[model samples]
Target: MKRARTIAWIKGLVAIVVTAVVFLVPFAFVLLQAAKTPDDASNLTFSWPTHWQFFQNLRDVLATNDGLIWRAFANSAILTVGSVTIMVILAAMVGYVLQRKASRLNPVINFFVLAGLIVPPAVVPTIWLLQGVGLFKTMFGMILVEATFGLSFCILLFRAFVGTIPRELDEAAVLDGAGPIRLFFRVILPLLRPVIVTVIVVQAVAVFNDFAGPLYFLPGDENATVQLTLYQFQGQNLSFYNLLFMDILLITIPPLVAYIFFNRQIVAGLTSGAVKG
Candidate 1:
């Protein structure tokens, strides 16, 4: 018994050390690279920087082209929050309805959503449609597009999760003179806290990191998001490598902060259905 316990302890220590190193090594590289000069960054890729220029890089990047990064950052924040809000609320409501209804029409609607998950959007047709609708290149149009793309999966998660919630609660709410909307907003929705967190984190990350959607749908330089900020860092001849690094670093921070704060909540929300359902 003592020998087995000792072996188990040794194995646990090895696993912990390996896990730490796996996560730490890349971060160490990012920080080191962020501080280096273009010459050092390119020539000595993995070598330590003789001088750390974190603040210098940040200053130059922020001050570039009359503070354009600030605009990009603001745009990114607006897009992320607006798009994710639409995605999560719509997904939650649709998922809840599908879970409760479970009728023939429900199955058909679910099948159409599942089909969307499989079918790629036709880019040209979509662009034409948006132009026809007078929503092309507009912020709200992009927001709607992002929400539509995101909704199917969010709805799927909600449906799976809501299944675990008893129909008894719905019945009880009805008995208390609660209509569908009231029961949903007051009762069933509050119980969706865990899944809601999951949806928020997942959609927030997707929106913040989205390049393709914004690039194609909302291409104005003034309306550019973080991913588009890289364009400003580029030049015809010589590029500001340090400023580029700093731009990348600033763009990384929001998602990093979000992941750090909600990592546990997201995991709990997503996995809650495993046992509950």
Candidate 2:
């Protein structure tokens, strides 16, 4: 028993050390770079700043290109909120129906859902379609793209969670004269809290961090998302390493703060439907 306890203790210590090295070290490096003088940051070493310029670097990054970073942050927030809202509503409805209804088309729908996960998006075709629909370079268009891309995974999560819900609640709601909308909104959706929170946090972070989607689908500085703002500090001949790291640190905070606060909820949501009682 003592030998087993010793091994477990050693294993836990090793895991903690590995986690700190893998995650904390990179974050510390970025922090150090962001706080350094321009010359110090340029060296890109994991050393403390010779002259700390954290606030100055932050001001410069935020004020670059007439405060493009602020605009990028606003656009990213809007896009993340819009896309995640659409995904949660649509995925929940589809998952509920697919799980509850007995339809021959379920298999076909399932195939397409899985295909959405497997198939890489055709960017050229998507852009062409957006252009044809007059949605090119529009916020709404980017929202649609983000929502659609994330829908399949959200569906799978919702469907798995729906299975854990008893059918008696549905019958009871119907017996109480509840319509489908009310049944879902009032009765079912409340029960879907776990998976809903999971989907929102996960997908919101993804949409906010997405670079290529905004780069290709929503071009122009006005529509620039947070990830696109990274280009501001980068140039062909010159790069502002301090300001670049500052921007990265700034943009990384929202997602980091979100995960920190909702960490437990995310874990519970993800594992809640893993085993149905």
Candidate 3:
């Protein structure tokens, strides 16, 4: 017993130290650089700022290019909300159907869903399709791209979680004269709260921090997401390290806060259906 306890204690200590080094160290470095003057930050050493310019750096980041960060925040907010909403509704509905019904197409549909996760997106084909549909470089188009890309993962999660739910509920709802939509929206969806929260937080962070998606499908300053604002402080020739770190700090906070608050839910949702009851 004593040997086991000592081993567990050592493992726990090592885990904590690893977590701090992996997460806290970089965050501290970014915080230090963000607080420094331009020249001090340019050095990029993980040391304290000689002269604190935290607020000044913040103001500069926000005020760069006539407050592009503010616009980027709005665009990212819209993109995240819109895409996650579509993903939740569509994924939940499809997952419920796939779980509750046994059909010839189930295997084929499952194959396609798995394929979506395996196949790397062809950027040129996606761009051509968007242009053909007249949705290229548009907010709605970007939302569609994000939603489509995230759909497969969300569907798998929802499907797994649905397995943990008893099918007797479906029977009861049907006997209660509920229609298909009512049965799902009123009964099934409410029970899916855990997975829904997981999908929302995970996908929202991905969409908000997606540099490539916005850079490719949604070009132009008018459609900039928060991640794109990093370009404002960085270029091929010149870079503003202070403002760059500040921008990273700002954009990182929302997702960090989300993870902090929903950490437990995320774990529970991901592990919910792992073992059959």
Candidate 4:
């Protein structure tokens, strides 16, 4: 039996090693490609370059139209931060209320939230709705849309994590003359730090790397985000693989750097959803 368990452990180790390689190799190839020049990029995406052209590529990608990469980066930062801030706060509040104070209507509300998970938003209708409110193709409009899309997951995560918080704390706070605001912000919310960090890390990433919504809803040169900047890089007539690779690398770096930094929370936040029951 001990020998059989040893063989199973070895198999698990080999499986993990293979899984790591499967994800890491392609990423390494992209990194190597991004570090190379036009000559090296054209010859072999996986090969070592004669000279490091990463600085040139980085500079060129960020220096378009004399200096548009920084503008796009700034735009990305705005959208990411704005969208995430709204998503985290609203989702957390709604989740807390829904989970803590269940009502006969909660099942209905939960169904609607669940619909957000399954149903794709009607883009044209959404645009029309926003335009009716005089917000179409605007920064705030896009931020709202990002928040709306992100809310479902954030709410779900908060609901799961909130379940782990003892209701007795909320009771104690209320008995001590604490109102709803005080109870949430001072008492219950701090306990939610771990899950909030998780949600922020996850949703921030989604907001940062978003493409389609920015592509269709917020289309304009003035509002071109990191993903949308690629549209300019790729032209109708001719495409430059070398420049495109550089654009990809520039856009990829923020998210990649973020993942490396918050990778632990990313895993914890995702896995913690299973902790409540």
Candidate 5:
């Protein structure tokens, strides 16, 4: 028993060390670098700043480019919220149908969903399609791109969680005169809060931080998302490492806070239906 306790203690300590190195160290380094002056940040070491200038860095980052950073934040917020909302609702409905409804087309639909997960998006064709629809270079276009990329994962998560929900509830609700839409919204959606929150936090963070999608789909200063604001601190000749780290620090706070607060929900949702078999 004593030997077992020792092994467990060692494992726990190792886990803590790994977590600190992987997450905490990088976070602390960014915070420290963002606090340093231009020359100090140039050194790029982990030492404490001679002058703590976190607030100044923030002000500079926000005020740079006539406050383009704030505009990027607004754009990211709208894109993240819109895409996540649409994807979650659609994923829920589709997942529920796939899980509950039996049909010959179920396998075909499942194959397509899995294909969506496996296949890389054809960017050029997608651009052509969006342009044809007159959505190219627009915020709505960006949202759709983010939503499409994130849908497969969200649907898989929701489908797993929905599987754990008993079919008796559905039958009872339907017998109570609820139609398909009413049954899902009124009865089923309430039970899916855990997975729904998980999807929201995960997808929101991903979509908000996404650089490539916004760059490819919405290519304009006016349509810049938060991730694109990183370019403001970089140039062909000189790069503002201090302000760059500061911009990173600012954009990172929201997702960090979100993960910290909703971590349990994320874990719960991901692990929700594991033992159902």
Candidate 6:
């Protein structure tokens, strides 16, 4: 018994150590590089900077291209918020219906939803479709794209979570003369806060940091997202490593902070939803 316990403890410690080293090494390197003076940063070596210029690097990153970084940040915010809001609400409602309603088409619909998980998106066709709808190269178009791409995962999570909820609650709400909308908003939604938070955090991070969707679906300088702004610090021949790292550090803070603070909530939400019918 003692030997087994000791082995498990050792395994856990090794896993923690490996995880920490994997995540923290690159982060520490970026932090150190971002703090270096331009000359020192240009070297791109691991040695400590003789003169730290964290503020200068931040200012440079922000001020470049007439404050384009801020605009990219704003675009990312709009995309993240719009996509996540719609994703959460629609996914939750649809998940509830799918879990509760029994119909001939339910299995077919469920199969397609599950199929969405494996099927890769056709970028060219999506772009052509958006163009036909006159939404191409637009922020709204990108928002819809991000939402659609994330919808399947969100629906699955919500469906699993909703199954764990008692059907008695729905019946109670209906007995009280509540409609579907009221039942969902007033009764079921409040109970779904945990999984909802998980969806929001995960989807927000994914959409905010996404590079390819914006790159392919919404091209051009005006529609550039935070991830797109990384190119600004790099040129054909030369690159500003300091400003580049600073930009990365700036754009990375929100999701990093979200995960750091709500990590426990994320875990709880994910695990709590596993008690399916």
Give the C-alpha lDDT of model 2.
Answer: 0.94
lDDT of 6 by residue, 161-210 (tens): 99999999999999999998999999999999999999999999999999
C-alpha lDDT (0 to 100) for residue 50 of candidate 5: 97
Off by over 4 Å in 3: none
Instruction: Evaluate model 1: give its TM-score.
Output: 0.91
lDDT of 3 by residue, 73-128 (tens): 99999999999999999999999888889999999999999998999988999999
- Model 6, clash count? 0
lDDT for residue 257 in candidate 1, whole number 0-100: 90
Residue 80 local lDDT, model 5: 96
Worst 10 residues of 5 by lDDT: 268-277
Q: Where does candidate 4 have its weakest 10-residue lDDT segment?
A: 232-241
Clashes per candidate, residues 3 or more apart or on different chains: 0, 0, 0, 0, 0, 0
C-alpha lDDT (0 to 100) for residue 210 of candidate 6: 95
RMSD of 4: 2.3
Reference-based lDDT, residue 31, model 1:
70
User: Which is the better candidate, 2 or 5, if ranked by TM-score?
Assistant: 2
Clashing pairs in 6: none
Candidate 4 lDDT by residue in tens digits, 57-82? 77777777656767778887898889
Q: Quote model 4's TM-score.
A: 0.90
Models 1 onward score TM values of 0.91, 0.98, 0.98, 0.90, 0.97, 0.94
Model 2 per-residue lDDT tens digits across residues 1-277:
9999999999999999999999899999999999998889889899989999899999899889999999999999999999999999999999999989889999999999999999999999999999999999999999999999999999999998999999999999999999999999999999999999999999999999999999999999999988989998889988889999999999889999999999898998889878872
lDDT of each: 0.84, 0.94, 0.94, 0.82, 0.93, 0.91
Off by over 4 Å in 6: 1-9
